[model samples]
Target: MNAAEPGQPADHVVLRRAGATDARPAADVWLRSFAAALPTVVSPRSADEVRGYFRDVVVPFRETWVADAGYRDGIVGVMVLADDELSQLYLAPGWRGRGLGDRFVGLAKERSPQGLTLWTFQVNKPAHRFYERHGFVAVEYTDGSGNEEREPDVRYVWRP
Candidate 1:
C-alpha cells in the first residue's frame, strides 16, 4: 500500500517504540493534538495537567509508540496501547490527515493481532468517521461519566 493516501502530503515518518526520554515530547504532541482535535470535548483538566498525565501516567504505564518526523527529533504523533485497548492516539496539528494515523493504526493492529478496542468521544465526529473507515465498529455508547473529559463516548472494536 502507498504510504500516503491521495491528497495527503508524503511525509517520511518513523514509527518506533518510544523510550522513557520520549515521554515529555510525546506528551506535548498529545496535548497539542487534543487541543486541535477535541476542543469541544471540554476536558476538566488544564493543558499542563494533561501534559503531566501523559508524562507521568500514560507514557510510564502504557506501551507507547511514537511517530517521529524523519531527520528531526520532533514527535508528530503518539499511540498508547494498554492490553487490547487503544488508550490514546494523537497527532500534532500539522500532521493530521497525512496518513500518520493510518500508520499508527496499522502498528496497533500488528501489536495486538487478536483484536483491538478504543474509546472516542461521541462529539468527535471526525474521529468516529476515521475509526469507522478503518474497520472499527461501534460496540457500545456511554454517558459522559467514565472519562476525564466527561463527554459522552462510544467504544469501537476492530477484529480480524
Candidate 2:
C-alpha cells in the first residue's frame, strides 16, 4: 500500500498487512488514542493499568492492518481486524477527524465483504456515530466491562 508523504495533503490512506515490526507503533497508537478518549467514556485508570491493558488485550491480537503516511515519526494509525470483527481502529489525536478511520473501516469491509462487527462502550456517542456513519448498526447490548455487573456496551455490525 502506498501512503502519501507525510505533511502532504492527500486523499484516503492505504492499508497494509501488519508485520512483527508493526507491533510497537500499533501499541503506541492504541495507548495514545485510548488515553485521549478515556476520560469521556470511562473512569480513567492509572498509567500502569493502561500499560497492562495494552500488554494483555491489545498486543496479542494477531490480525492487524496499519496505515502510514510514508513517514516513520510514528504510526499514524492502526486497525485490528480479526475474523469478521474490527477489534480496534485508532489514529493519533492529531490525525483524528481526517477521514482515516473511515478509510480504515472501508478497507476492512473490502477485506471482509461479509461485513464486520465490534463492541463499543454505549457511552461513547462519538464512536457510535462514527460507526453508524460507516454503515454499522447497533445489534445488541451486553456488559461493557468484563465484570459481571457494569454499564452495558452496544454491539454494532456492518453488512456490505
Candidate 3:
C-alpha cells in the first residue's frame, strides 16, 4: 500500500485461523459473497444451516481462516481449506477488489505449497478470472450433477 493510502490490506487486513467465535461472522461473509457473486446459483443450505456448518464442521474440522479487516471492516472474508482443496474463498461484497481475495489465495498456496485445487460455479466468471490470475488452471468441468447446487462447475489446480 502507498504511504498516502490508509486502511488497505497491508494496513488493516489480518488473516488468522478461524476460532469458534468467528463462525457466525465468517459465515455471514460467505453468505453475502455467495449471494453477490453467484446470484443465479441456488444454495442448498439455509442461513442457519450454513452457520451450523461453520461452527460444527468448518472451524472445528477444517483449516478455516478469516480475514479480519480491523474494526471498520470486521470479518471481511473467509477461506476454508480441506487438505489440498481450497474448499471456500469468499470476501464481503463491499470488500471485493481490495486485494483481500488475492491475499487469501496467496496464503492458501503458502499453506499448501505443493499444490491446491478448488471448485467454482462456471457462471462465476470473476472467480474464474481471479483464480486463473493466481496461477490456478482449469482441469475439469462438471455438468452440475455431483454438487448440491446442481450448477455447472469447474475445477482448478495450481502446482508449485
Candidate 4:
C-alpha cells in the first residue's frame, strides 16, 4: 500500500540519500511518476536508458534522494539536486497531493539555501502551481528546441 493512503500518513515516507542499489527502483519511480503526471509530454529516453542514466550518472554524481515507502513499497519518490538546481522531483501517482512534495522541497531548500532552480513542461500546470506555492517564480520560458523532448518548458527559481 502507498504511504499516502488512508491510515498511512505520508509522513511515514522516509527521505534518504539514494545509493547505487537504488538506481533501478528510483528509475522506476521516475518513470511511473513521469507517465502519470506528464502525459502530454513525451519522454525521449527508453526505460533501459533511464535506468542506465540513474545507475551511471544520477546515483553516482547527483545528490539524489528517494522516498522509501516502508520495506514493502520500496522507493515511491525520487528527487535530484544538481548544484543549486532541483533537476528532478517525481512521486508515484498514488503518492501525489501528500505533504511529501513539501518535505522534498524543504529538503531541497536546506541543501541549497541560497536558491534553487527547476524546469517543467509548459503543459504541466500542476507542477507550475506546486512550485509557485513553494515560492518558485517563473523566470524564463523557452520554445520546444533546446530540450530533448522538444516540448515548451518554463524555468522556475526559488530565492531564499
Q: How well is each residue in 2-54 modelled by candidate 1, as lDDT tens digits? A: 12344556367888888888888898888788888887767688878877887
Instruction: Please identify which of the two predictions, 2 or 4, would achieve the higher TM-score against the true structure.
Output: 4
TM-score for each candidate, following the candidate numbering: 0.89, 0.77, 0.93, 0.95
Question: What TM value does model 1 have?
Answer: 0.89
Give a tens-digit lDDT track for model 4, residues 1-160.
4345554568777999999899999999899999998888889999999999999999999999999887767898999999999999998888888788999999999999999999999999999999999999999999979899999999999998
Model 4 / residue 4 / CA error / Å: 5.1
**Rank ordering of all candidates by lDDT, starting from the highest:** 4, 3, 1, 2
Superior candidate under TM-score, 1 versus 2: 1
* Alpha carbon lDDT at 13, candidate 2: 54
- The best-first sequence of candidates by TM-score reads 4, 3, 1, 2
Q: Hey, what RMSD does candidate 2 come out at?
A: 4.4
On residues 1-160, what C-alpha lDDT tens digit does candidate 2 reach at each position?
Answer: 2333545532545567766666767767777787686555444565566446555655565577777655644467888877899987888766777778888988889888998999887777889999999999999987756632255788899987
Give the top-scoring candidate (lDDT): 4
Give per-residue CA lDDT, model 3, range 1-160, as digits (tens): 1121443444478899999999999998899999999999989999999999999999999999998866755788899999999999998877788888889898999999999999999999999999999999999999989999999999999999
Overall local distance difference test of candidate 2 = 0.73
| Winner by TM-score between candidate 3 and candidate 1 | 3
**Model 3 Cα shift for residue 49 (angstroms):** 0.7
Better of 1 and 4 by lDDT: 4
